[model samples]
Target: MVSGLLWPIIKKTGPLLMLLGLAAGGYWLNRHYREILTPDIALGERLYQQGVDGGGHALQGVTQNDIAFDDAQFNCAQCHRRSGFGSSEGGNYVLPVTGTILFKPRTFERADLFNKLFKESQGQVFRARMRSAYQRPAYSDESLARAIREGVDPSGRQLSPLMPRYRLNDTDMAALIAYLHQLSIRNDPGVDEQTVYLATVVGPNVDSADKTAMLATMREFVEWLNLETQGNLDHPNFSPGYRSDFAKAFRLWRHEVWELPADPRQWPTELASRYRRQPVFAFIGGMVNGDWTPIHDFCEASRIPCLFPFTDLPPTGHTNRYSMYFNQGLILEAKAMGRFLRAQKDPETRTVVNIHSGEPRSSQPAKTLTQSLHGDKRYLVVDLTFESIEQLRDQWQKLARQQSAPIQAVIWPGTFDKTIAAELPLLARYAERLLLPSPALEANQTRFPADIAGKLYFSYPYELPTAYHPHAFRVRAWMNTRDLAIENQRLQFNTYYALNLLQFGLEHVVDHFSRDYLLEYIENEAENQLNPGTFPRLSLGPGQRFASKGAYIVQLVNNDQRQIHPVGDWIIP
Candidate 1:
């Protein structure tokens, strides 16, 4: 009777008890796994790149002397950079916070001696040799939180006051740390132990001779670089001092030419196929005849750097991060022309006739010039579009018949040749002043007549031919030594400048091999006297994609001597 009574109770309570136990265990496991494996990486990326949090609010921080800052103005990407490889700026070293660097124990070695010296110099390195090496344990999650929140390192040492202490809750902090843990952990796609691969995109519209010149210059530079790198590695004398430390950064450079298809629509597919076959670290010294929007889109999508392509047309109206141009190309020239016209004191120059071949390259600038002169009541802007050279001649004749005042004529011939050169003299007869695009004069400098040259005002983007630039001589000397013909000075010099810039940027990087890091260095060091005199000046800063910022409205002076002079100071509009 007693056993039977106890059996009923046991059966009823035992199953309920087991069920409750299982529920508790499951809950605990879920929480543990969620904390370890399910951080919001997308949220972390937002906070890192845009300085916005999960709630879409700007993140806040405090720097030296408790100066408050928001992510809108100063985000992590601005300093540590998108790749998490920190940069050295104005003697202050921003330490790398990537998982590759943070998750491992930090030990001081002879290779890092220079970095340590600069980092710990406190604005002066008078006795840097006397400083001792530093070591710290790998960061635990809690320590990382403290480091971010309190500006402290894993070794319990205070970080530099320049480093900002961010205000983040546990969840946001966890997400950010998660992102950092995986940032730049693997080597970039195009690099290996011994060689780094690069590519240059040659558009379908580029001339055969221009393409040949660009490719030859790039190949010669690569060959010379590889030879120098090999020599340094093989020589016993290079193994002794700081040179050996930097020798680790040296790698043989191998490059490929990515030629796009004829159709613009197929360019993306062609580029994708090429990239799929083999990825490249960057695109350098590219040349394209038409719009560069397709290549720009491809580069931005793939997170690759497109540096200094030779073109008169670049993508418009979009903010870019990976592509850097020498200038705004045709757009810059057009805006400069508008500003030049508006500043004129002559009241007789009232009507401005903007004529183009209706091609995208010419029409876009024609439209841009109209927009720049939109509200200025001093001048009336008129747009004339033509289909061909024959149509352009007809349109010019029509304008000449209707012309009344001493008007100014701006011609944007999409393509320049002997036919276009022949029309310049006729166009000059109708207008008091004639302005031609840069390419018009560049292609037919020797073909213009003496009478037409006086009225000609070319939208010149580079340094005037009359100006003395010492760097030009140096560039020519280098080309001469290499046995390269000087057929296109602007194209060849710009190519040579691009190669030199790549070499400088790579030297500064010293084996980090992050595309973002390379770009950051280029932006910071672009104006350090590296200009090869193609432009008046070449410089870039944070978020500045164009290196040369201004242009001149130059007048052709002597037709026989082929000399041109700027009418005024360089205009930056």
Candidate 2:
């Protein structure tokens, strides 16, 4: 009787248990298979950043805020950066969307809230501003969607007036949430437990003295940095200003020298091969007299950070993330000269002659100037290979006679020699309007003659020497103590400045070692705050490849003194 009564109950409950088990198994399989198909995090990131859908379609969103944005101007990453860290715009701060912030409990002071949301908080654990903005509980997926769609917080409080209410479907919204869950969680290469590897690149045509000087400064800087951070590297102690998690992020600097081949074409291949063997976190300072385009391309392709190269002819117009230059180098000089030539008092005399030795490095400025003219034939290029004083004089004379009209101006993009001093006084008789780069002339200062002091106008790219002294005094003293010969003042100062800037930037970066973040930090913050080195004022911004944007047209003053006074305003060409 007991068995018969229990049998019915067992049969009924057994089927129910089996059904529940099968349902749970089916759900797990569906989830596992869905992950294989949709890579939710990556898909969401693509949709958020690129405004693209899973099927390679351009995803769109509509916003009904200040201005109705029915178009793709509603990209999530545009306002809330790729890291899901929101930004301040037009007096309003956008809320962060990262899962770490969105799904966590809140107990943070208002003062520390801003830092936490931006990932800039150091040694302070704080809740995100978004989470602290209301008295509501943690956000559920449903509430998050409602917040995004209705421009309201989880606490039923309205968002800022500038906040755009986005319209996203369930699938897209889920993907974005998944992406936010994993944002900024992956570890980047080029850094290890004990070392942060860097590479310094050099071109085939770099001057031996300059190459030596650059390498020496770089090596010494690395040594000094390692020594200063020795305790941190070994025992892992976070400084007062740094985040505790970044205690072990400090590492010994290990650098490698990469020398590119004489053939520009081989640089990409060589850099690729070298990188394959030993990848680097960043490139410090590079020197190249010839084309840097190949190296620039390599850096962009390989996604390596390249800081201020000693090259004038940097590739332009294309967008870049990895490379930053001191200035257009010689190209800025040419543009300044071009503007000077265009502003000449004599409009009738349109023909300006550019005299350069046939060397590739010297010819670059003229090419840049000619290109800047943009089909305006007022400027003329003349390649005169002068081996001796007689040859230079002969070429100068020939050019003087060859001009159909009074020459508007003459530009010598190459270095000045002792021979040029004698020729300049004579040449001044024919061409009173002469343009010479101050850098080229400064090297041969002793050789410069008294007679032609006031005659030639120089394209001065830096601040006056006296002005540079104040900013460069400490650096100069340091170099002197090290007994490093000041063979090239600009090169030494630039190298020193680059290293210092990199160090300061790395301090701010802490454990975030993204190459893009490093570049962004340098471009946005370091460029503005750092003391001016050889440059009068150095600055870089989003999409700006060059640091120094303007040049001065100044005339030399005092007989044989090399003193100069501004001829015109600082011109940005």
Q: For model 2, what is the alpha-carbon lDDT of residue 432?
A: 57
TM-score for candidate 1: 0.90
1-573: candidate 1 lDDT, tens digit per residue = 559869989888998989899999999999999777687988888888888887788888898999898756567887888878776666566778878789889854454346435433455533432243566799988899999899888989987787889999888898898888888787677888888888999887678888888888887778878888899878836558777777767788888888887888999999999989988988997988888988999999999988999888888687699999999999999999999988988756378899987677889999999998989887888777888878888888897778676678998888654357788777887888888888887677465877777788888889876667778898889788888887778888899888888887776677778888788878877887778788889999877899998899888676766678889999999
Point out the worst 10-residue segment of candidate 2 by lDDT: 120-129
lDDT against true structure, model 1:
0.82
Residue 228 lDDT (model 1): 89
TM-scores of all candidate predictions against the true structure: 0.90, 0.77
lDDT by residue for model 2 over 1-573, one digit each (tens)?
A: 559889989888998989999999999999999777574777787877887766666654435444555445467766666556454433345565656567765344333233334544322223333454445567777777787778777778876555566657777778877786676554456887677888888988567988998888887778878987786655543544543455645677898899988888788889999998988988888988667888888888887888888876787755576798888777788888888776666646355666666555567776777666556555555545554567777887887888777664455535443335556776777775677775556655664565666577878888776663455778888778877777778787899888888886666555656565566557655554465467778887644668888889887676457677888888888
Root-mean-square deviation of Cα positions for candidate 1 versus the true structure, in angstroms: 4.4
Worst 10 residues of 1 by lDDT: 123-132
Model 1, residue 29: displacement in angstroms? Answer: 8.0
Best by lDDT: 1
